[model samples]
Target: MTAVALLLTALFLAPTGALAADKIVIGVPTSLNFLEGKEANNSVKLAVDEINKAGGVKVGGKMLPFVVESIDIRDAAPGVPVPEALLGIEKLILEKKPNALVVGPFRSEALLAGMDMLAKHKVPLLGTIAMSPKTEAKVASDPKYKYVFRVSLDAKYFVGYIAGVMGFLGKEFGFNKVFIMNQDVAWARATAGIMTKIFEGKLKWKVVGHETFPTGASDFAPALMKAKMAGAQVIMPVFDMPQSGILVKQWKAMKVPALMAGFISPLTGPGAWKTFDGKIGGALNAIFELGNIPSAKYPPSKKYYDAYQAKYGVPLEAGHGPAPSYASVYLLKAAIEKAGSLDPDAIVAALKATDAQGVMGHIKFSKGNQLIYGNDPQKEALGCFFQWTDDGKRLIVYPPAIAEGTIKLPAGMKAAK
Candidate 1:
């Protein structure tokens, strides 16, 4: 053969498509019995499975299937040390060597600790459920944090809705006094702080009582009695802990008259009524998403909800956790396709320019590399305050445009005339 023919052959074979397909691995280090983690795991699996079924994703002229690797970061909350979470992530990295992680540790404590390892290994992650402002603040200002991206609502994004709901309840019910029950964590504290400011300074409501409890406390009777005696019209508990289940159950059993709202994770799921054995009647919760309600302005939102129900035979537990987890996988794919390579730096750059629409809406990252929401009512995310009906359905009562029903007071309580 001629020398020129041999050179041409070499050039044709040089395309990356001729090489082995790239494997995109997802690592989820969630705690045991935490429904949010399981929801995220299943949601991610659904997205990955769908992509694989459709001939996988094409990158650099080659189709590559996604690979998922999950681990249990036991006791993964603020009470646990940061090093323990770091160890769990390190294990996943050593075992899987993931190209990218769509979901990571569930809370800010673990996320903050796991960032350094992710950066060192050059693994790009799109976090789904960690809601601390520090996660974005650090990534935005520090070059060391370039690899970490948050696709879910953070502290600032969620606080706006919570405060808005508090203001609405005040005006709607003529409730003039409020009490705050906050768990001692960064996300809860930040939410409580903003709510206090909005309820006191802007809404002109009296601050009746402020209570702080450690996570995992089963008894809320003392705090409940204190708020009731202080004449608080609203009781805002700002925490995502499982013990929050105890607070809601106790409130009903003890017959606390004040309205319970804000950061109510335990009450967000469909089975919550049965969990407490019908003890959570008339309880208000700030739910970021719901399948039945027109919570998401985006049309694809309903499609996601239907798919999830068909696959799992149950409603999504916490919409923020699973919805964002499923969306993050697609977002990562979009970024990789735009970049045309699996290189982390290129993917990060493409993510910065992301404006793709997902189940949540048209998702775009802010300067801090955090997903932005709630700025536009017609287009972006809008959280609802839902109260449980007597028949066990969550009825949206805030932001009248999409509300399923009006807010009804608990059987014994009356709104001011």
Candidate 2:
């Protein structure tokens, strides 16, 4: 063929500009049926929409929009086989070829499975939930696994905040003795151990009855009876099971009213109050965020909460849910802009140097890639402890510096029938 004919052929074979829309694809691999999944997905949507409206992230003088593609991992239970859980992330990476991945597996086991795959692929992962300390420890243990970073508070930080609240409960409510109850899972186990140390050693609160139940244990009556028998002034539950509603209901049915707080995942959402038919009232619990809480140092939090309620018609669930996921997107955008490139290594470095404010407060990365927010008593994320009032509203009651209300023990606690 003549040179002119060859040139024409080359022109035709070159990549078409028609398919070239500057956009970054983020892959989310999680279980949509679960709370974390729904919250993270929606939060990411909110952030992406906001960023896109504001002209997206600037890369090499070109603004690139972001699109999130999700892979449903189905129920994120710790009992699910690791191989099966890993497959979701594998499928997402292989099918979507996203610029980064936001990992929000509700179970620690699922996060563990996804971690290895993320490290192998060298894709930067920003984990929002999955608070197992083991995840960050693994990353710290191996330099090759630096690609994984947790944007949410881990178990240690969470337990620390819980301990702080327990101390407050002891001082304010005159609760000298407490009972410990938790699930057998890793996160709960770690929380129980930490609380044990804090109560028994540091704070000098007596730990009376300690019980561990399986994730789906339906009967907490025996445990409540034992706690009351032991004269526990407070009953703390460290759990992650959806069936925690059973425990709460049993607590009320048994009328064992030691001021309750710890592993409050089940009570964080507004829907939970109705789900349990308002039985959560008078229950003191630790929550990571609330629409009007003072720990939400970020000015946009109330706006985010209002917008979420307006959009979903329910209060925003606090914890490692919507807030962190929403903030993670903004954090990623900041990192990408700081890096000025889409390369994984560059983005990872930028993430390490992250220092931005979002709905979750001023997000900054510390040692082990842990995201620190607000004025935590510890150097990690700020923790908020709240109590559900008789009026069906949650009031912040701990960390006196930021508390919006005082501790209110259950009505029948003194009688302890």
Candidate 3:
């Protein structure tokens, strides 16, 4: 009788012990595509470090240490015949059986390449920079893709933000005709499509000119001259930082009359600011303004900025890439605690149920695994417009509540006569 009782007790506790032993692994497949990738990966590292320092993730009444296994796959060489990095990632997933995955600073093409593997494994992927709708389309059609998610907002949200900024410009400053110049990348093309739809369909604004440039083109003089010739009052250029900086310099040299505005990226950082000086303005989804950090409302922002500067020796840029990486880890932690288990399904449920405040404001997931935050007053993607001061300082101009200072049009691009 005594032996029977002891055996039963041991069996009852065995499953609990096994459950407690499960460790939650998070795979980080970060891009080395450019300097932006480096910045984003550093932020991810910082977030993981903070979480580990806090004793890792808790699951089933036991604490399981979180591990971040990073894969660096940068396309630096031409025709070097690199192996498919996603296959290696798949192998890691099968062996480690991670609870979630953090993907990309990689190009859309690279991310598209990995979608099949991720779907096959049923692992959730939160991307930092892959923002094309096609990526979302893949998840929507795949029954196995219930696990994939992205921290970055889609093209629809981006267009909505642009519309809001344009509305503000029209109502407040009497600006009308606009020109849009977009790179031939998936993201840029999608953004241009959305902008055209909103301006033509909803706002009834005239698109004076529309132009597309090949990605990585050295000079933008021809495009700028064409926009000027078309009588465009606002020049909205959608390109990455390096090329955008070159465009700004060339536009200045060519003496284009249109004022510049566009989405913010690594190009709007201090490095780009130093080069472009007084020639940038647009809606910024992320802005690292010092005055915006009021301790009363956002204590964590101050702490994060201070710690980031202390560790990195430079101020953090206002880009979704870095902030989402940090927020995703914390979000994962919250989900784990809520689920009380390391099961992926349970964690996913917890994540969907989240209404927690994160560094990038409130992060809540909808039924389709889409992030539902950042909707503006027009029920669109919420973003604030900002302009570079003549002295070259970035300032929040729209949304009076968060404005650090008033919006000032560039010298040559003042409201149309």
Candidate 4:
């Protein structure tokens, strides 16, 4: 009788034991474009490690461990031939079949490719970068692609920021006419189009000039000269990191006097500032600097910053792309645990129901597939306007409350005489 009882017990426990051994795999597709994506990938890995140390995710009366599998799609060398990174992402998705996907530090084109695979699989692809509204439109237009969502503010938000800054400058500083230069990418074009409508239609500011440049074009001398000749008070250049830095440096060299400001990648960091120190004109950023603040109203920034610096031995910067990526892991874990199951549908439901406090703020999803804080609609996702100090520190100048100090205009950015 005892032997028979023990055999029954082992049989009953076998499936649950195997389930305990099972791990939830999360896929992260870092962009091949810049270092921000790499940092985001690292942050996601760190969060996964921390969760595992805390005994993994608890669901369905079982504790299942989780692992983050990162795919480095960044181009490493000058010109080594290899499979296109987007195709590699498709292969990873098909092969590993992770439960969820977190993509990018701004690669709208690449993300557009990966979204096709994710939609086919019906897996959730939460984006930390690639904020084009067109990407949102793709999901909204198709009921079948409901699994796609973004935590970051859309491109329109960037346009709003630009318009707000321009309005402030025009009203306060008597800066009127403006020139807009944007990269030829989908995001840049979309953002620039919106800005033109706002400046021309709403503010009544004259659009002295507008131009589009190829994404990797090195020289901005010709474009800058045109804006200068047009007597524009502001020049808004929307492009990626390295190129944006190069553009600013070249603009200064050409002695372009326009107040230069636009969307810049957080990845530009201190290194980029070091190159264009005291040269970059008025600048506004979507991300707030974590290290500079003593205690943010949001709690997770400090905690995450401390843990990250302790582990990585470097002060976390606004451009450190991994901060939000790391937070995504925790956010997903909370959703899965709340749902009490590993089923993708259940997880998705819980994620949509998410009103949990996150590093940024209380992240809640709306029917429009937008993530915003429940506490404040205006304070949805973190963004700020910052300009470089003489000492190369990024000082928050807008929104008043979080200002490190007032914005110090660079030498050549004075009101047009």
Highest lDDT: give the candidate number. Answer: 1
Q: Write the per-residue lDDT of candidate 2 for residues 175-281, one digit (tens) a residue.
A: 77989999997667877888888888989889997999987887888999999899898899987677887787788778886877875577876677788888877
Per-residue lDDT, model 1, residue 337, is: 85
What digit string (tens of lDDT, one per residue) describes model 3 on residues 4-107?
A: 99988877876422443545678776655555456566666677788888888777667777777766655322332234556556666777767788756356
Error of 1 at 8 (Å): 19
TM-score of each: 0.87, 0.87, 0.82, 0.81
**TM-score result, candidate 1:** 0.87
Residue 301 lDDT, candidate 1, scale 0-100:
65
Evaluate model 1: give its lDDT.
Answer: 0.77
Least accurate 10 contiguous residues by lDDT in model 1: 289-298
Instruction: Predict model 2's lDDT versus the native.
Output: 0.75
Give lDDT tens digits, candidate 1, residues 57-143. 778878888888888776454467768877888888888777777667776777888888888988888887777889889988998
